[model samples]
Target: MDRYIPPVGRWKLARRTQQMTHSALRELLKVAERPDMISFAGGLPSPDALPLARVAEVTQRILHAEAIGALQYGPSEGYMPLREAIAERFTRNGSPVRASQVLITTGSQQALDLVARVLIDQGSRVLVETPTYLGAVQAFSQYEPSFEQLASDADGLIPELLSPAQLHDVRLLYTQPNFQNPTGRRLPLDRRRQLAQLALETGLLVLEDDPYGDLVYEGGPLPPIHSMAPDAVVYLGSFSKILAPGLRVGYLVAPEALMIKLVQAKQASDLHTAGLTQRIAHQLFTEGFLEPHLHALRARYREQCKVMLTSLGLHMPLGVTWTRPEGGMFLWVTLPPQLNALDLFDAAMQAGVAFVPGAAFYAVEPRHNTLRLSFTTSTPEQIRRGIETLGRLVTARLSGLS
Candidate 1:
């Protein structure tokens, strides 16, 4: 008898399912997971930074003391205590974030998805940065909104080019102002103000996705654009970086009017974020597990960043420029125009190193010579070795060695 393998591709599938493509970063991540590979690829917080003992302690406390509340189904808007905790933290900037405005989600990624579902219609205009976070692009693309990238530089997004004509029919403007993914560019104080003003003048809804705002190394925190233009912006915050990503705790603050629609969307999506994690996260937040933990994370990531920077300086060929971020896990690299980072990917793996090509982050035209390196996971020694391997590969490519 013939084997019973079915023709899976012949089955009818939804247009949306057919349209969806796999994430290149995820594909690369599989390769990076090998024991032999030293990956400067994933935007993973260091294991050393994760407060495992404290997390276990919190989990024990929640399970023992508030077992019913922790395990039960939660409101679609989120756990009230966690929401309150998030709202209080928002006041750190003195912008007066209220608990009423906060809505907890599974993750900030879900917040993006909910906002896109609520606000975007097919072909709606959505403004984004030139090299935005791939996750955002992936999340928003499902809603079929048209994307327009605003002009940007080392100082971050420039909304100066946001003319009145372009603002017509624009639904949302997405940005990662502090230590952006792939690029790691922090928007200056002036540009943040400019974006807020632009939103006020044109009524462009700003999605200020901030997962790394508190990880600043050199300077004090800049107020989020949502604070500057509360009515005009939707603020996203995540505990993924500061706390364990496994907790998947994230929240958003939007206008109450908009929050109603978002809550409806959240209800249809997954009912709500998990109750137990929210309770544990809230306990951690209120009991002061964050401050000392955050300090340790900053110290560890700072050292790793320093190692990568030094390695790049010593080994990379001249004209291969990279961003020097003040904080965060990632740094962007722009190779000389002649060398395409995509072409170098396989070679990098063969040489026992991995990186994310920059083109994957773009919503429109992509620069072929750019790539992103994540420094937080790898140790100083591994970073040195990985950079040396990558440098040699790049050099060989430059010299016409296949």
Candidate 2:
């Protein structure tokens, strides 16, 4: 008898399940968790910056003050007070954002999935930044859209190549214009305007993901593309960076008509984001905890970034170059053509450091010579040690010594 035929063998998974591959970054982050390894792999915000004491206070206050409201099931559109608070944030920033246009999500990731579910048919054309957010790529892939790479430079996405002809039949353009992950590049004012102009001209929709916008170290906020072309954009924001990520609250701003469909999509997914967390977030924002907490976080990341940058400059061999990020937790590094980041992973982990290879960020034409380093998780001393270890390893590889 053939070994008992498992019932699961007869059960085929969805095509999307077949398409899903393990996240290299997630696996690397786990390797980074070893006690002795100094990891620059994860995009985690600094743990010290989490307002634990305040969270404790707020937890007590919310439960004692509004237990019934916190525990109850909420609307698919999100808790009403949080929706109003988010809308007010947009209004205060010079955009006319109405509460009616907002939809709260489990996280901004859910927003991405909802957009893909409601808007994308299989094989629909979608424009994405070259080396875009890995999570966005994963979320959007469920619908199996044909992805087109938008060229990017130091200033971020290049709108010139994305002319009207290129955009015909394009379902949506996904981008992270501020402190973009994996690369830590931000769009300048001119590029932002050009992107908005191109989208408006072609009547294309833009999914603007901005989880790291507030992580800008020292500068005024860059006006979101949605602000410039409100009707043509869906904007996503998250509290994971400023506040604790464990809360799992994020939202999307889109036109009301579009939002109705997205809310329905969301209803099918999770019914709603957690009511307790949403209400707690609303309370925190109303009490003005975000701005001040963000200032302290920026300062911490700025100093950590400085240490990492300085260490890289001091130790990294020639043929290795890295981004000097103005804000955000990460910087991108490019090694020589001969040194492949994916190939170097084992050596890196063995040498007491771990990082995400840059190949995972690209939708097409992945660069094997590149990698990303996150600066927020380590102490300045740990950063120095980690960079030095990495530098020594690269030098050895280039010299054929290890």
Candidate 1 residue-wise lDDT, 1-402, digit = tens: 632444457875554554367888898898887888898999988887788888898899889998998888878889987887788777875777788899999989899999999999878999899899999888888777888888888877787777888888899999999999989889998888988998899888999999999898878778888889999999999989989799998999999999999999999999999999998788888897788888888998888899999999999987789999999889999998999999998899888898998999999999989999999999999999999889888888888943
Q: Candidate 2 has which clashing residue pairs, if any? A: none
RMSD (Cα, Å) for all candidates, in order, is 4.0, 3.2
Q: Assess each prediction's global lDDT (C-alpha) against the native.
A: 0.88, 0.88
lDDT of 2 by residue, 200-251 (tens): 8889999999999888875667899999999999999998888888999999
Stretches of candidate 1 above 4 Å error?
1-11
* Model 2 lowest lDDT segment of ten: 1-10
lDDT, residue 216, model 2: 89
lDDT of 1: 0.88
